[model samples]
Target: MSTEPDDIVARITEIVAAELGVPAEGLAPETDLRGIEGADSVRLLRVVAKVEQVWDVELDDADVFGVSSVADLSAVVASALQVKA
Candidate 1:
């Protein structure tokens, strides 16, 4: 898989959209994830779970909590991918 940020953002956007029951096109890297209609902590965690499953990378609690948007999540994912690589 490509480790580029845009690719990571695209993948994260898809995961967030599915997990939050939102349209993929409506999501963007800068979108406030918590502002999403059903994006409570549990649902966000679920999104993180799906991301980890898809990318085969484990994210730390600090990293997870530090994310407020799809872009931040993409950064975390990219960092994890780098470490894994």
Candidate 2:
């Protein structure tokens, strides 16, 4: 897959870190989001909401739910940004 914009990835990582109570530095592209400590559907959705707010873009539920890791989420965000642009 192609790389996403650095700014988009950075902001997405920041939102995930803030909402999930995980340090941004601890998250990696292959990190399993659902496997993260204290992570649940609710918390994950909160992260998604925060991302939407931060980027002023909406994400599809299918795409959000289908994402299993940080990199997948970043890809979804990048696609959304491309559509918006």
Tell me the spans in candidate 1 whose CA falls farther than 4 Å from its real position. none
Which ten-residue region of model 1 has the weakest summed lDDT? 1-10
lDDT of 2 by residue, 1-85 (tens): 2235766667667777888898999987778989988899999999888878777789999999999987788889888878988
Model 2 regions lying over 4 Å from their true place: 1-4
For model 2, give the 10-residue run with minimal summed lDDT.
1-10
Tens digits of per-residue lDDT for model 1, 9-79: 99899989999999999987899999999889999999999999988999999999999999999999999
As a TM-score, model 1 comes out at 0.94
